[model samples]
Target: MRTTRSYLALALAFVLVLTGQSMALARTAPGPDGQIVLCTGTGPVAVLVDDQGQPIGPSHICPDCALSLFQALAETAPEIAAPTSWLRAHPIEFTLVFHSPAPRPAVARGPPQAA
Candidate 1:
């Protein structure tokens, strides 16, 4: 398991380096009508364009982007403990008893064995 974790960490680091290099090499240019262009999985796509076919200034994050960020955060967020009040209201009780093991019965000895 430790070896597997080390290999996984190395692989993740390599992937991140490659991704960073690729992103650094690639550049996104504006569309013909000065529309905001963003690189998508398929290709560069025009986004945040106005009715006048011009790029709109970034004022606020789009709902879809906000939702995606929220989901990412939720996935990475650490687990939270249950409320203290609730735990106090509903307490758990248990009894742990340890008993000695039973003694084994001894078998009767057989008659003297032949020489």
Candidate 2:
């Protein structure tokens, strides 16, 4: 009877661990809106949301581009960029929002001289 109880306890513990991990994964998963927001900077920072109004994640930016963005933000808003000292420090939050699709840029026509 004691051995059975011990086995059951071990099983329960394993199940609990698995449940916790799954919950964490779910939180990180993209929602129906497919968006995630991260808070960036010290305070009162602004983040651009996508067409769906979802806050874009850092992964969307390439490493080199991200660095450039950080530098630019630092110059414009030192307080916001201060948290970027850490390699993984992301000071932006992505919020899902609704946006009308943007129209494509118009193509330029031939020069007047050619007409």
Best by TM-score: 2
Q: The CA-based lDDT of model 2 is what? A: 0.64
Question: Residue by residue across 39-99, what tens digits does model 2's lDDT show?
Answer: 6686555555566886754333232344577667664645544464656666998999999
Ten-residue stretch with the least lDDT total in model 2 = 57-66
lDDT of 1 by residue, 34-65 (tens): 46678999999866676686666543434335
Report RMSD (Å) for each prediction in the order shown. 26.5, 23.2
Q: Report the C-alpha displacement of residue 14, candidate 2, in angstroms.
A: 0.7
TM-scores, all candidates, are: 0.27, 0.28
Q: Which ten residues in a row have the lowest lDDT in candidate 1?
A: 24-33
Alpha carbon RMSD to native, model 2: 23.2
Candidate no. 1 TM-score: 0.27
Best model per lDDT: 1
Whole-structure CA lDDT of model 1: 0.67
Runs in model 2 lying further than 4 Å from the true structure: 34-115
